[model samples]
Target chain A: MRWVDLVKVEARIAPLKAARPGDGRGSQSARVSVTETGGQLSRSSTGGVARLVAGGVWTIATADRLEPSIDEAVNTLRGTVEIDLGSIVQIDTAGAWLITRLERELSARGVSVSLVSASENARRLLEALAPAERDVPPPPETIGVVQELLEAVGRTMVRSWEDLKSGLGILGGVVRGLSIGLRHPRRMRFTSIIFHMEQTGLRAVPIIALMSFLIGAIIAQQSAYQLAYFGADIFVVDLVGILVLRELGVLLTAIMVAGRSGSAFTAEIGSMKMREEIDALSVIGLDPLHVLILPRLIALILVLPLLTFIADVCALAGGGMMSWAYLGLPPDTFITRLRDAVALNTLFVGLIKAPFMALIIGIVAAAEGLRVAGSAESLGTHTTSSVVKSIFMVIVVDGIFAMYFAAVRY
Target chain B: MRGAGKNPEEVIRGRGITVGFGDRLILDNLDIDVYRGEILGVVGASGTGKSVLLRTILGLQPMRAGEVEVLGVPYSDAAPAARSAVDRRLGVLFQHGALFSSLTVLQNVQVPMREHLRLSPRLMDELARLKIELVGLAPDAADKMPSELSGGMIKRAGLARALALDPDIVFLDEPTSGLDPIGAADFDALIETLRDTLGLTVFMVTHDLDSLYTACDRIAVLGDRRVLIEGTMGDMMAFNHPWVQQYFRGTRARRLGA
Candidate 1:
């Protein structure tokens, strides 16, 4: 046997050795040689029949030593070969596979092979191997990188188009739901809308207040340091007032709500979709769009503008406090300068975008949640993508609003 | 058949094994033995520490008292080399298959072989294929992920992994739980065949009455924090425990008898 084959045989024997209860069988196994020193293979011609004899133990422990000889012996045979296993004492899966493989090789060469005097265990194992050996799979084909890249691009385009079509469908559902609610206001699930308002809007007060406050203070402090060189510290109040009222307050607050409420919406609805609770709702004749999505959308639209107003006041107060602390400007004069530098149009500009931003976040999150599949992994993926896509679109809409308000001179 | 008392070498022996979670004692000074080359079916009602017994014997649960011996070697707190030697000879199939969802069937079968053997890649492929075929899975199913398979195929794939190293004793936790009647019967047949061909000592924890009736060589009933009785199906049929009477001759058991 080859040196590597010897090492492999010894490795398999180690587990069998440790598995046996006592050490007495260890010595018995050591004396059982796996090589051709005791094993024998004989071929004889009798009455125009080719008979091949297999003798001694045929097991995994002896497989490596016997494999090459078995392969060589089977190749030298012709049609109508009889494999006589009357003298073979033991056989394992590896030994059985080799015998079956030799039979397969013979069949490919148009030499019919037959077995005689085989053990029952060998016959049963060989029967199990027959179907697998017959139905061999072809090797996989290697593709060029350009082909793979083109395939991926095609798949992505198809997915994006499907997403767009589904978005339009959701929009139609929302419009239809609103029209139905208008026709019968009392049947419009007012309680659910109120409940969601408290969850998404009223519950978000502290976080939105604190985040907008810190942002307002940071802007005032930085702009004050720069304006101090120009000896125009009082203008910090006007700068803070215009920036927070028109852009920063609503933009930052919408982003916060998208992360907080959008993710919550996706997780809650995605888990429902996963459990088929949405299916149950629809089966009971309650439109999922009306029962699940509509209330959430209306709640967000109402709550976001209210939240923007809170953020606006808290930010102005923070700016006034920072101006008082660092620039030594009193609150009375800060409001006085603020009134001169800004107008109601600036404040209304930020409030105007809040509802639309809320709509985008609410719709995107709800849509992503409904897209969840059967598995837990899919639910997680959709939830993460919902938060990411909502945040991205919120910023994108904010940028578009900035340009639109600039163009129309709002 | 070997008698109970005469040089009966138990491949697994548990003595006075007491395991408790908090104040609730699960197994109280339980003693059990699994003889070599026999399929011992452990049965019990739900929440009756049947799985706890299997886990404790496998050294997964820490016992407050008593010692456990597997393959004639004490496993708990033993020398690392001695414990590892015993581990190489034992295989466990947990409930639900617990297959790695990310790995394909072929890769899952290869994991144990890769850790245990130094065979060539070609030999490993051949061996894993044989194992897959042995477990009655189609050859093409080897490349499929666990999520892609049906419940029955998952259990078969798990059985293939358990047989990867040709372990001396295989522990199966509720192996037939999620399968339909036909599927569970086929699985029981597969277990019986494996034991016959491979000389395996199987310790199966099951609630399937059909398995206890047809597949097992002997049955052990666990209740009241210990093994209540262990013997042949005839012995179980004649045993006098009230829980055993209710369990072995219940409406479901009578229907299974039909």
Candidate 2:
């Protein structure tokens, strides 16, 4: 009984020896004559015997149609049988399936099947039947170009609709607030008056003072040199005063406040909104509009006008310094000329534009701020928008005021 | 919890509460009544409307269809002054505590008292310190900012702030979330003690098992679009509902020491 335990086999199977036809070796068969009593087997040929005893021989040949001979040989093995699977050079699934069934049936019958030698293809075929072996399924298909395009289009449409809806909702709230303000005139008017004082008159001081001081220094430097050339240096006092009172004073103050306070209002309210504090207020039975917006609006309005007045004084002082250096005009002489160059109407025109610009800044910044949602990311976006919108609106309002003042003068 | 001896009916009653977000129904015709000095826990998976329920009742979120009566005050029908008067009767510990980052712990705790009552600075400071002490934080912790405290410490500070007003009804959202097990257990003990000592009607939303077992007088299991079952721990343990059974059973599939 030539028994082999291929089930626990670990060693790599050596290659097969192919016998050429008509080389005194049988064409149809290669036989090993075993001396059963000695428990040793030898090949028929002298060369085959030497190689068999020296290196253990195996065969390789195709099974063209020898099913009967193969079945008969496998059945005659009563104890155990080892096949030189290296001989199986060509075998279809038909042959492979037969081998598998035979292995299972013979093992159950206490007849073990072993591989003395196995070809690469035969081992692969046999291993495929092992329980854990499986084919790796192909990857998921790529999304088609048309499908990708359609999905992108769908997402864009959804986003656009969401943006439009949010815009409409905010616009509706603004319109409602305005309508109520109109219907309740006395309340709105009083609020407007107070806010004008705070936002426009009062809060615009520091920036106005700083800017006017810088402007005056620049004007003094430029005029002093120019006046030296003309030898009419003293007239620059009138020049500085006229420019300060007529234009730069109010315009500079308005632009400064628009950037400073406007961005501040937006970021503050926007952050409050992002934290759901606004909603928290409403939930507690407090009107968020009255509590948050009204006070801020009033503060800006009340401050702007006062700031414009301060800005005028500072700009003139700056101009006076320039005049004193260039035109040999003292601070007293500069003030006297300033008093003569522009009258009450110039101050009134500048102050009038201050409140309008203040209103534009307040409304635009507060509106943009209240629109903030989500996290800190949205906070940055709303703050930027608030500053930009406030500045733009302030400039536009200033243009309208300029137009009206121009028309009146004409 | 001073009203510990009072009957359960006198606690908090919510009638026909229905809230919606635009067209999506968040809560529909929901009614919850928490007994005096009882810890009522609201439990559910994420997005099952647990937080919404807490908000609507706390008056931090609006009620589209129902009335919330806290203590004896009819909060829904109350005027602004009356509503504020009602708000004065309750305290809220938000999920994130929502402590003012600008104010110190003591100032945060003293806010409601300063706004609604006139107390001497000394008295206010004493009260704030007392509340902080009750929450097991150092008296010196009162001067620190909310950002300076750990997660558990922030929650304790928030609890102190909530307890400042000596509110009868306290609403806490996920009080033990983000805390370690031991810290969470300590928080549970603190909550249980607060319920006992203050005689507060506690309405809490949480997913913590220890809190449900140790603190809650009764548990409401919110699932399948509604509260499928609500009962004491003993009753909940015996609940035959598939979700409840599976939840209590947990994953017993793995063999130990295999």
- Winning model by TM-score: 1
Indicate the docking level reached by candidate 1.
incorrect
Q: Which lDDT tens digits does candidate 1 get at residues A268-347?
A: 99889967899999999998988999999999999999999999999998999899999989999999999999999999
lDDT of 2: 0.64
Complex DockQ, candidate 1? 0.23
Q: What is the TM-score (0 to 1) of chain A in model 2? A: 0.53
Question: What fraction of the genuine interface contacts, i.e. the true contacts, does candidate 2 reproduce?
Answer: 0.00
Q: Write the per-residue lDDT of candidate 2 for residues A252-323, one digit (tens) a residue.
A: 787788788788878888888877899999999976665566656656665777787888788777777666
Against the true structure, candidate 2 reaches a TM-score of 0.42
> On a 0 to 100 scale, what is the lDDT of residue A125 in model 2?
40
Q: How accurate locally is residue A304 in candidate 1, as Cα lDDT from 0 to 100?
A: 97
lDDT, candidate 1, B126-156, per-residue tens: 7788889889999899999887898899999
**Which residue segments of model 1 deviate by more than 4 Å?**
A1-131, A134-136, A174-207, A271-303, A306-310, A374-377, B1-8, B16-23, B52-90, B114-121
Candidate 1 chain A: 10-residue stretch with minimal lDDT: A18-27
